[model samples]
Target: MAGGYVVGVLTETDNLNDLARGIAAGWGMKEADIPRLAQSLGQPQLQAQLAQGLQDFSDDNATDFFVIKATGTGAQTRYRAYTAIQIWPDSAFPVTRNVAGSAAAPNTLRIFSDFQCPYCKQLWDTALPEWERQPNVYRTAHYQFPLDFHKNAFSAAEASECAGAQGKFWPYADVLFDQFSSWTRLDPKDVSGRFSTYAKTAGLDTAAFKTCLGQRTFKASVEAQYKAGVALGVRGTPTVFLNGIKLMDYRSAEEQAVVQAITSATPSAASIIDARVKSLR
Candidate 1:
């Protein structure tokens, strides 16, 4: 147990009833009397543990729970313990070769987003201004993960990719997201035409943009990006990974979380991209 946190592991066959019976046996009590013992004890910690155990058993394979407590000399000093039965999985999204900053930058922010996601637009609005101010500190790479529910999202992703081929991906994305509501609600057949207009508005060649859209030039690549995000366990848009660490609750205080993450990250002597590539060998 580290920092007052303990992870209890159970095999696939273990059930909550078995766990309760085992606890009763440890206290030299009949299994039927466990409920009375629990009430008599009246410990919040025990109650929480029992609840978590029951939940874990119901979930069937693996689950996690957290215990938080205040400690140390200062009242604000708190310790959090994360208890889990298995190691959390890591994301396998590939390193992006295309980005706004140089590969030599120490910090890298990989954003998995969808054009039609409102939360992603909110995150973009909240985080980009601050991020652009610190251009030298970190590089930003964007990946598309259009959800299946959003009928027009996949086409929008493809449109952005096509614009990217003409060196207008970021601008096209900005316009696409800015006009999300208008395009997303339109009939599916008309969404592609709207993207062509957006491309023109972003100052791209209208004819080429229309041709690209008609041909669906980047469909495979856009689908590939979405698949990569799914493989990385991305359930929603605007999932940001900083220096390879997924930032949980980033929306609570988006800019501060991003800045703090970038600031606290340990700087290495070699470029992050180079080190990552070397480790793969």
Candidate 2:
């Protein structure tokens, strides 16, 4: 263990006691005590080791975990990593650019998306539109989150904002994702001009849109949105929130938690999403 955190390996089994005791064993304890872990178990180890413990993530809806800290590194095995998460209230993510439905709709979908990310493209082409069409179910707020590696994404965000200026943000966004492959193939320097062509196809005033794109009118807005996403623990494109509950990591072992949080309509949705997120982490 190092950096004020210790690691533990929980076994891939269904027994709840194994999960509890594995965590206890990590802290050099002989017996597993559930309350003891929540109190004070964050101990630094002299050297990290690969300790065996029990974990129950084998099933889709995992409700229990073994509390074991792995010490002494250099073992070939699955590792659990944790990211510090801050719970932000719903209002922190205001819907500045409403992509679909009304802001006053029952459920809100706040998305931090990048144009160049293929998954973002897939989300755009598939689930997003279906959600939008169900106006009563979801109202979307699209925020720019241009990954630094995607060289053209920042400018693409600015261009989308320019489209927003002309009241065609959603339609223009459609064109962007629809032609994702074509534009991504071009050199970054030529991407803007290509976006202007797309602006025309989306039925915007080409002259006005061209002027807006060339002047970089919405660059600051895009920058601010990206920074806000980063501040709110967004490490990748398409990080999402459903009515303010931050969704779980897409690449995590538990994929259903994220999906259920976004789609579940139960009245206790917030608490359910929070529990699911905690379980996944």
TM per candidate: 0.61, 0.62
Give the Cα lDDT of each candidate: 0.62, 0.65
* TM-score between candidate 2 and the true structure: 0.62
Q: Which regions of candidate 1 fall more than 4 Å away from where they truly are?
A: 1-91, 95-98, 252-281
Q: Write the per-residue lDDT of candidate 1 for residues 144-258, one digit (tens) a residue.
A: 8898898888888888888888888888888987887799899998888788889989999989988988998888888888778765556777887665545666655664354
Tell me the spans in candidate 2 whose CA falls farther than 4 Å from its real position. 1-87, 249-281
Most lDDT-accurate candidate: 2
lDDT of 2 by residue, 1-281 (tens): 21222222333323334444554454355554555543333333311331443233312312222323343444433333222223356666634654778656777678889999999998887778777787876788899999989888988899999999999999999999999989987888999889999999999999999999999999888888887776666778788766554666433425434434433444343444345345544
